[model samples]
Target: MKKILRRLRRFIRRLLGIKPRMVWLTHPVFLQHEPGGSHPDSPERIRAVEAELKAQNIWRHLQTAEAGEVSDTQLALVHSRRYLHFLEANQPPEGKIYRIDDDTVMSHDSMTAARFAAGAVVAAVDMVMAKKAHNAFCAARPPGHHAKSGSAGGFCLINSTAVGAMYAIAEYRLQRIAVIDFDVHHGDGTTEIFKDDPRILFLNVFEADLFPFPDLEKERGSSPNMLHTPFERGASSLTFRRRIRNEWLPVLGSFKPELILFSAGFDAHRDDETGRLNLHEADFSWLTHKIVQTASSCNGRIVSVLEGGYTLTPLGKSAAAHIRVLAGKGRGVDVMRYNRRLKQRT
Candidate 1:
């Protein structure tokens, strides 16, 4: 009812003409966490995204803010005490890299960067909650979807989506919050974190056969509130659309989330070899539109966090497409400029 009133007011404002708000949260502190030496999850990913948005001229429309580091209390929202200590204990000396797991690594500044990345998401939630912005995109690195409570995997550390969602529950006193993950890999960490909580609905659509293979049956996440739509390797745009239209939308409608969060991963793009899915820029644009429409029903609030998108060219292009839709730019992606930017990088 309140959302209806807000929309009515917006509709009235359009008669006088006022624009909706969109914000982007990022920081140089996010740049300080590089693992070095051919790491796919390098800080350069953020640079690529930043440069692309500027090259495409979409940066002009976004309100930009630097993310503050997360408090210890905020870290506890989703991480264990031991895990917190582990990140601190495992930090490598300056100019060195510490391998946390098979694919996860940390440097002297890793903990700080991870905190800020997670903090950026929490801050995005705050922005939407306080109406500082209608929607936000967090282009921070070292993606969090694969981080478990006490373990880091798939280049993730603190499970930022979980942190942000729990922060919404505890800080904003919100129930029925929904987290949607469209990364090429399943958001196993996020699913595990909210497994027992029916109030926090988790929806994931990832490539069916991918890395960090957990028991598929076990990953049903102990509740019907959790929905997983896994697609095979050769899955294309048609199947992705079908799943979103048929599988995700129905559940999302019934859930009626007060706020929505996206684990926006561009690695699912066909141009990205990190994961083998045939999604294109149009697919990313389409997903964002659907999510935005869903958010409209819930007061037009969304917080999007960067998860996975290894290949730079596709990552930049896809992210720009996603942000365009988020910024209400109507699928406006500068593919020619993105291509030029990629060529310059090579």
Candidate 2:
């Protein structure tokens, strides 16, 4: 019955020439990557998000695409050739796991999965640039914000967000692109990759004294293009929203970005044990809505890539809320269905 109703809605929209503006990108290799030994960056993370989106009946409403693998040459745009070659050369045996650092590891198929994760972002950029979609969410695994140009850290193998940003600049000649990261931990890798590039503006907010780089809290005022907002432990929802509105929104409006890429991390959810900050699903919806309104002024193009979300239930719920707003679903139930019911009653 649900499937039938969904198809009916699609058919009616087609008749009215109403096309969806949001695209959801995923790849099977995301599940194939094994980080090994109770690592928080698990395949189950993507599974949880998928299940929730479907459970909320949000999955069938948008266009879905399988992400293709990124090419080595394209990867070289942001990553070092030596690092790319090293990642290519170091693949563990089928049964073994290779540890890149204390926090990151690689299984036999990890490289393939990493390439496809980056590929999802690349595909999303192409879709939005071509105006095929207003925005996209890449739900692939092995998050990329932590991976630098030359090395991997904090479970990221390839810097997929950087790849997508560079791809947009190179392929579309876009200037003044914006990358906003609201993850629990600092996006040290993204900062390192884009700190020198004047074309890109990187805005990041993370928990102070958390994992990765605690010193980033002190260096917040150093870079002109890079803006950092570090929250102390147990920061509340009010603090989160207030800071974003005060700090991120003004800069975003003034920058008037050609494209906005979100490192959409949900680990800040209060229930998630990975991060100490406190945020809820409603906050995420509000954030996405604000981003959408900002995008409305500048061609309405956004590409959101998943970063860090550890605990299962909150991760799923938070991601659904974010995707819902991206799909223009708003904070309430589906508006189309509500309209149809009202018409029937009338």
Candidate 3:
């Protein structure tokens, strides 16, 4: 009887160890039907990462989910109704791109894709709140950080992160939410939308003098709720990690955020063509670990969304490492599931 009880105890602990914290994956169709002629923001970005996740064997632990279309009412929480109307009504000609300014473009499926991407984030919020998983990641495209309240830019139509933050606060009554954007480019859109609100803390780290270069040091939001760390070209991962440890982490702890959202952009990777930062696959994994540790202290609520990582090899490898850490899968495990819900969605 003693031996049997010991074995049962061990079994319970092992089962608890393997249980997922929580993970959500967006559908592949979210990438399909874009308007550009093979732009960097193509479907291949998510596909490569998905393949690597499967190759890593980390995919099995994540719960699969579909990104439903966000309602206009929810979208209006962050964007203007007029702008939303314009985006829905104006569809670009097939096989041609309609520029939403100089940096953003629209294809036939852009609207639907954007809606689903936003919806995926909302689903993540729901899952986290329901305690289905410890945290979740939204692997959708047409990145949202650079999108503004009234205009679409930087290949982004809707600010998915912003919309998710709003949903958490308004719908779920989560106070003291925080958004940490690690994209190589500043999240100007998220900043613009939440500048006046004190309920959220928007922290960003991006390359200095990159696209949408106007958000420099003097660009203060309506509240002291914003912080920016602009690194020069060739900034090393060590330096980046130090900033997080010394600067960002302290502030985040003090804030005691109820929920943490990551604008996870791999464009800062060394091999990425978008920026000069020299981050590696290890950097993404370490950063994810740090974020998870931080979230664990606050009831383990985290949501990571795909932002910008263009190079196929680095993007796939880096994203795989990040997701591996998120899923609590042991390192070096190849063959992960691409979309935990892919089989169901099909």
On a 0 to 1 TM-score scale, where does candidate 1 land against the true structure?
A: 0.89
Model 3 C-alpha lDDT per residue in residues 1-346, reported as the tens digit of each score: 7547745654675578754455756876677747465578878888898788787776766666667788888899989999998998887766766777766888878888898899989989987887766788898978899889998988899999999999999888888888989889988898889895778888888888788785474775435888788888898766887888887777777788898888988899889988899777777777777766765555778888999998988899988888787777644422224222223545
Better of 1 and 2 by TM-score: 2
lDDT of 2 at 185: 91
For candidate 2, lDDT tens digit of each residue in 1-346? 7547756765786689886568888988898888875899888999999899899988877877789999887899989999988888899999888999988999999999999989999999998887767689998878989898999999998999999999999999999899989889999999989986889889998998888855864676777888899999888777887899998888888888999899999999999988988787777887888877765555778999999999999999889988988887776453334335545755
**lDDT for each candidate structure:** 0.84, 0.86, 0.80
Please tell me which model should have the higher lDDT, number 2 or number 3.
Answer: 2
Q: How accurate locally is residue 44 in candidate 2, as Cα lDDT from 0 to 100?
A: 93
TM-score of each predicted structure versus truth: 0.89, 0.90, 0.87
- Native-to-model Cα distance after best TM-score fit, residue 150 in candidate 2, in Å: 0.6
lDDT (0-100) at residue 266 of candidate 2?
96
C-alpha lDDT of residue 293 in model 3 = 73
Clashes of each: 0, 0, 17
TM-score of 3: 0.87
